[model samples]
Target chain A: MTDNSKTLLELRNIYKSFGPKHVLQGFDLSVAPGQSVVIIGGSGTGKSVSIKCALGLLKPDSGEIYFDGEKQDSAKAVARIRERTGMLFQGGALFDSLKVWENVSFTLTQNQKMSRKDARDAAIETLKKVRLGASVADQRPAELSGGMQKRVALARAIISKPDLIFFDEPTTGLDPITADAVNDLIREQVQALGAAAVTITHDMASVRKIADDVAMLYDGKIIWRGPVDRLDDSGNEYIDQFVHGRADGPIQPSM
Target chain B: MIFNPFAAIGRASMAAFSEIGRLAIFTGRVLLACLTPPIYLREFFSQCMKVGFFSLPVVGMTAVFIGASLALNIYVGTQFGAEQIVPTISVIGITRELGPVLAALMLAGRVSAGVAAEIGAMKVTEQIDALHTLSAKPERYLYAPRVLAATLTMPILVLIADIVGLMGAWMICVAALDFSGPTFLRNVWQENIYENVSVGLIKAAVFGMIIAIMGCYQGSNSKGGAGGVGRAATLAVVGAAVLILASNYVMTSMFADT
Candidate 1:
């Protein structure tokens, strides 16, 4: 059990909807300090919304969010949470118009005191931590390959050494080998930062590689959660069907 | 089934009203960001260069050709004793009407389309969401600089266009119309006061704001994928043009005596 006092981030009974489509209902998640929690769910299951609500990127229709054990109900509290966190988007989302280093050092550039040269140098240093060479730092995001872009995004996310990091399908489009490498990099970097991580992905390999604990989202709420070691025997029919990749099960495909 | 025409009309009206309300709120937030901290000086200067400097050639070309054409048309139209007032009418028409309108229309096509496409792409790819998580307000980092730049730069661009346009009239008057260069220059200066210039510049500033707002609004609100971005660009240009013409009429009415 996670000590409530020690929770770095927590979402309690979040509900969000767009028009008539109810995306999240009674969704809850919590990440302890230095823990890696991977959320598993089918597409459109609001796995992403869970983390987005926690980050305050998407306001929940109803919920309470706490960061660093402080309730983020006020605008100032939400701003503080945003300032202390980093996110790696599914598409990498590097600014295509900016050079690689500029993309990596984006937050620092907003500081007004960091010279462009100094920011670029810091970006290059962070890139090396993700096993990228300085040469790639000058190239545009469009000029890089998919795997390289993911690494660059990882570098960007960790460049600030944030208190928490959120990854949205961090390995979605990569090759199996590249995905494994990124998963390793994510685990190593999160440990190095001593930061809690909440990742959203349905990729089972990713879950096994990166999650200290696993949470399953279904029908707009968390239905199952357990340590990674217990994932195979979670015994929840939904999770069992999901883990075994079975078509014949209680979980039905929607039209 | 059953198609109810009045119900459909009501729905359409409601949608349009909703869209207008959203745009108003969006513009309000951007304006507030303009006065707040973290103004993004580099982006402001960069947008100024883009909106004012880079647009010089297009604006210049349009003004010059229109000025020359107006001089010829007025010279031909007033073949009787009214020929002497050709320079005055040409100067008034260009500065008070054609110069600002043409320049803004050109910008509606160029700047609006570009801004819409770029911001639309960013939105679809989640860069805007990334900005949100990064603690960077998109209104501050993206919208306001462009808005402020366009607002400030349009008048400057129009001022240059006014000069180029007058020069075009002067060239035609001296070379083709047999008017004395000295008299033509003197007439243009004495007849066209600073009021004519200020009214047109004021119109240009408002038109510039419309272009930026339409572009950024359509763009940041865009979704889906490439098709969505394409639609945003199209809507931005169309919206800017419509608003430009509509606002131009309103302002002209407000300053009817001038």
Candidate 2:
């Protein structure tokens, strides 16, 4: 039951398949504005694919994706939708050829045609928001540690002040402290920007910290969804097994 | 047995056609991206430096040695009787064929492999997807600049290669063939200058486009991980070299009467 008026993004009956392997089948999700929804699922599930579908990075074989209550089907419409959204990739995905500042302000300089100096200043400001310093502006992504790289990526994601943001495994490969820092930064940034955020992560700690609502994706569909407070007591067996980190559950480990 | 053979042939033919169709679509997309707005001039210039300027030493070395060797072979073939004509033939040969073909082969080894590896790595690391999310078209921002740079700079590289090759031939002719230095230089300068050089340059441009397109295509489609990037690089070189040779044959035939 999604309120159409407040829903920023809606994906209905999404189906996506890669050749013989069916990845997503009848996946449905709806994200409201200013809300942070974390989609949790086991590895090899369609969590990332669902996010990609929402971002227009991957096209679903069948289904409807609506952005701001308007159907997005054409390339022009997808481009328009993407222009208003930001994404933090699992690997940070900072351009290796560019400096940190350039990577952060890439959308501003390349798309919005902002001057290099202004973009650099804006980038440094955004980096500050992510707890990074102005000194890192000139360095490359390779020069930064994993946590620092994630911070830089977060800065880049929030630099444009997008209406919507997506985080794919934001705290995948970091120490607990660093991961918590990144999670806090994400929560703060999403709240500060008042953007609709859909984070695909397996980190339950991240879900507890950043999620307003938690949706569990299984077999390419949202099997359970509710407020973050109810995530531990969702009364769904799959959600219980997943949240408690039990291997013995409805989900079988892939060989 | 008949059915099996027919099925195998059909499968092979289908695979070939599929590859060709994909390549055609990729080329069409690249052309469309080039014509569209928001061209990345900065990326284009950087690629020009990488694909053209940085390739000078290897291309130059290859051209020189090939030119010298060609001259020596021609001198021996003619029994050293037609000393004067040796410079003309060698110059024409280097300018018309060896310069562009050899330079392209070298670039196919160096530039194509490099582009494929770079783009493949970017793809694997999700930088390409990052570009898409940033509202920047990858073809315009990444592929077009490289393809355009290689296409534009190749002719210039080939022209320099032609000159250097002739100088190399001159060195051999004057020292080994006992030909006067001035006479060798004069023959090289006067022998069908525009026609020979233009043909080589044109071939170089076409070869450059092939190299870049192959590299970008293989890389942009790369999957898996480090192994995938390595495969892309290898495929880029092999595909570019084969295409370069095939295009060279067609180009030579077209310019045969000229």
Candidate 3:
């Protein structure tokens, strides 16, 4: 095995801006194989921007994003990199026109060119992995509860058996207990598949359950990052303020 | 005491012109991207079914009724000439101009509005972003299929429109206008040409592309939430209808002698 292949995805000195407002500035992060790296930040603090840049949805003004140690600057490389990753969006984002199984099997049917029956079988298996009943597969996303929709989104994300997965605000809108369940499910899936994960959320509860390593984003840079066990005693005031959910801290709101 | 309606109309007119200019440039870029391909055929077929097949009933009904009315009007005008001229003008006008144009406008109202609303909601819900994250190109997965389907199906719809319209005109001429069957049939066939049918089909195809692309573009770029999706749908239908009418004039003139 190659030395860098142990690290599934890496971002170095990434920068992105919209108009005059810079979103990501010299951000550096790496996900070791099978590691769950959770990024915690306030809304609009470049957490989603970092994920978008890695997926090539938003172009970075400067810096390198590497998938399996290969830079993702060229179109060919970007396509190659993206094919190995999957994402669960905040809203579940399932196609309303599609049945739940169709949504889960979308990538396999569309990108991988799998046959419909084969895709459906894979979708059912993934649903089982996410603890969704097989009977729920034929129903549309509109028929599902909020928590059920999230589970279906999880099924979709893992259906491809992606080497890396990005979870964007996975627990944002769910009730606390449901959120905790989702967090546990995320943890279980990462471990079961031995896939690296980068989950972005503001919820400290999610971070506690899902993160092997936690990174705190502020002002376009990662202000603090370490093993999850060290988050409480990171000795960084910013991390402390954020983890504790204090409004008044070293970090100030803009006027 | 009264608002200056003319000024509001003038401002709206200017905004519409500017939007047209901007969309033209955007369309050129999309077309350039279209040439480079890893064509997503299933997505394209799905969208084609959505935009074209699903839109048939509305377009067909509009054309048939319009044709019936046109025949009646032509018969009334034909007091200046032989009654046989009603069939000739009804077939000529409807086939060469009205059928394609009206079908397109109807599609703009029905299918384009639906496309805009659907995609706009998708955008707001981050479904498009989800597609991107799944390693699928949104343009290919979403827009290309829609554009291709509309382009392919419009000609067929317009042909159906022409036939159905002629039938409507025939029914009106025989029953309402008291024109004889043999006379109506002869005049209608005599006035129709391969060029007329081809031109109308061509116009329908172009209008389909315009409707689908405009809807997809507006929806894909929608901002905010419910308000944004509403605006996108409204704009898509209104803009597509206007473009269909404006382009019909231009296309009709181009194929005038044909």
Write one digit per residue (lDDT tens) for candidate 3, span A147-186: 9999999999888788888999998889999999899999
Give the Cα error of residue B179 in candidate 2, in Å.
1.8
| Sequence-dependent TM-score of model 3 | 0.90
lDDT of 3 by residue, B115-137 (tens): 88989999999899888777777
Candidate 1, residues B74-142, lDDT tens digits: the string is 988886743358788888888888999999999999999989999999999999998888788899999
Point out where model 2 deviates above 4 Å.
Answer: A1-5, B1-3
Per-model TM-score on C-alpha atoms: 0.95, 0.98, 0.90
Interface RMSD of each: 1.0, 0.6, 1.2
DockQ ranking from best candidate downward? 2, 1, 3
Q: Flag the better candidate by DockQ, 2 or 3.
A: 2
Clash-forming residue pairs, model 2:
none
Q: Specify the highest-TM-score model's number.
A: 2
DockQ result, candidate 1: 0.77
- What TM-score does chain A reach in every model? 0.96, 0.97, 0.95
- Give the candidate order by descending TM-score: 2, 1, 3
